[model samples]
Target: MPVIVLEASDFTSPLFLVRTWEVLSGCITFSLVASLEPPNPLSDLHSTFRIFCMFVWCFFFTLTLLIHILSIIQFHSLIPVSWKNLTMTTAVLGALMGLSASVVFAWMVMDHGGRLTHTVAAAVASCITFLAYSSETYVLRTQAHEQRGYMGSNPGLLKILQLWGGCNMIPLVMEVVHSQGSASGLPSKVLSWQLWVSTALYGVCVLMSLVTVVVILGDLAGRCFLPFDKCLAAFSMIGVLLYMVATVICFTKILQLKELGNRAPTGVTELIIMETVVASITLLAYTVDLAFSIKLLCDRSHA
Candidate 1:
């Protein structure tokens, strides 16, 4: 007779593997799209942005692959757990990958508004990656802190996650509403202003995410070195609050200004639907994570 053994940790290992693989898969898929486009189709600046985006995606692909390999070994107990720095390092790398992608997306949008399929899709995908990475990094930090008993970890962070999730969700909803309202053709003035506003709001979202990364890093090592995590967290929430307000204003204005001259083109309708799907997935990920974090926080408080 043989005896089988399992640890509590084993239950969650598969989730990490799946999450990491999703990031890698997304990177590869988008990189292929960005790379296959004809060179110099736009201008020198546009060409350079595409090249940079391709490189960034490939970098994340390789990095996540390495992380996945190590994680599998770690989960099986084939490797020692003494490497406390590994997850933190990976988290920082993930953040950097996200930031790089965000910059490239912003550049593309500036060069050619989000009307372009490549630009819009890449922008949406990059934002999803940023949220995914940020959430995972937070989880890693929370696990480390809980193990060491160095911090009462989850509640504060969970608050941030919940807020972040809700706030980020508003813009995506607004985007979908705006898309539907403009199912007809868009006037040039309306299109131009919409593009600029969307770009600017994206910049704010990026900054909010970056601050969350900073807060996590500041606390992860059990150091109060930054001493300003709370302040930054407040600002992050404020940023999202403003985003929510802006989204409402934008949505209303889009409806008011939309032209009814022609029905939406099939391609345009399909693209908007695809983007909405992507946004929905991201929103669901954040919401689920937020709920899980809340449960963990409650369990810890009771314990």
Candidate 2:
């Protein structure tokens, strides 16, 4: 038997490039924001939170940058297997910072008599960034070995993912649309179509996810309609298809509603749409990678 050598470039994919950009851009943004005047000069609480948020972004993204550099250097074995933990930490910190910054932005809005100013816009951008990172973390979790294996120590992990998609992700998408729509002040007429379609698709996904859980459990109970692995893969493919469709619809509506050139909406709607598009693409890439890895694992197991 010949020994196979894996090179650093072998693991490099478009997703890796995208994530590298994500971390580097975030670092630059944080640096710039920190160098500027406080986000809200009048409110000490707001200014403090703004600084804190920038710090969090800087720290998290810098760590991510290091991780990528390690991967690029082919120090694969030196990289922690618990990489998902770093993602989870980043997600949690982002949530805290986003929410805190939102409070400051909200105060600014009320202070300015409910007008959508730059501060409000910044708040919305922070929220969208938070959502995007959270979604990315979800995708990262899917790639972890802990999420694989049907009869391993973590037997309920796959079931948990199914239920999470049904119970949490579907609702989360709806909330994101609702929030962005409200922020954009989109007309009821314009909101009806994309809103309806996206929600409907997510609803289907939710139902399918629930059915998948039941089918998987039934298979585990020895009443298999198909192999558990096959069922899981089928559900993953179908769910990804529906999700991508809904995400596309959402992106379309955002494009339709976006103002052009100098008259663009200074609110958070445009930023939310842009961030969602990036996150959706990232999720799609992650799903494809997961499928490919699973196939490779299956092949290896058979051999």
Candidate 3:
């Protein structure tokens, strides 16, 4: 049995207000989109993308409400996971997903022809929802500093970005895999190998990141016999090296394919270019994480 202990302060807090706005705006955005008629054949992609946006909204809404309810009931300690980490993770993911949804939904709505007024209104609401989620993330960060949660730290946040970047590469990798047999040549083979290697490197990095996150969240960092800080520094360094290789491979191979003109499948060049950009950003994040990890290790040694 769970006891219900409502905290008035929780409801009155700035975080609560932002979350309320998120829920309201999310509802508005989805409702508007849902009310519109099904899109025409040409706009099917846009319609499907809008559905993704709606799913994002619904996801955050449900999670936010659940967190609120949990907090009100004072059940934080009963949960298996760290409440603070969970909150911070949700806030960060919500902000990223909200921003992506807002931009994508707005672009889809504006680029095509139909129900302009309603879609535009929905886009505006989506933007507001993004802002709300961003605000929540900011607030959570400030609070996290005081709470001293792992996910609130610099390295922890970088891990989330790294995960996102790795996930972004998946679509491009899948595209390449799907069109594997469509082309046959030395250039094609080389390009495929490059993409595969890059994907593999990042896949390893993402796996390490997930392991690190679990260690931290499970409160096993201190209990583990391993030299966690040193291992993290080593992992970060290796990740940086791997990302550097991946970045070079991606940019060089992609450029070569572009120059070859028709060696690569249609639209793949563009996807690879986008993936390269994400990889570049992810590489920078890995570098920063390496620095932070080293600093933490040094500080620990001195202490």
Which predicted model would earn the best lDDT?
A: 3
177-281 in candidate 1: lDDT tens per residue? 455446646685776676566656555655655555544534442454653444444454555455455545544444444453244442234334433343343
Poorly placed runs, candidate 3 (over 4 Å): 27-58, 107-122, 175-199, 257-270
Once superposed on the true structure, which residue ranges of model 1 sit more than 4 Å away at CA? 1-59, 66-194, 218-229, 253-303
lDDT of each: 0.50, 0.51, 0.74
| Model 2 segments more than 4 A misplaced | 1-190, 213-221, 250-271, 274-282, 285-303
Model 1 clash pairs?
none
Clashes by residue pair, model 3? none
TM-score for each candidate, following the candidate numbering = 0.41, 0.39, 0.77
RMSD of each: 10.9, 12.9, 4.2
| Lowest lDDT block of 10, candidate 3 | 40-49
> Is candidate 1 or 2 superior in lDDT?
2
Query: What is the lDDT for 217 in model 2?
Result: 32
What does candidate 2's lDDT look like per residue over 14-109, in tens digits?
436545654655555555444445444433333333454566566657766776665566464444343443344444334444444444445444
Candidate 3, 53-169: lDDT as tens digits: 778888888888788777777887898777788788778867777876786676555455545678788889888888988898888877637574878887788977876666556
Count backbone clashes in candidate 2.
Answer: 0
Best by TM-score: 3
lDDT of 1 at 48: 40
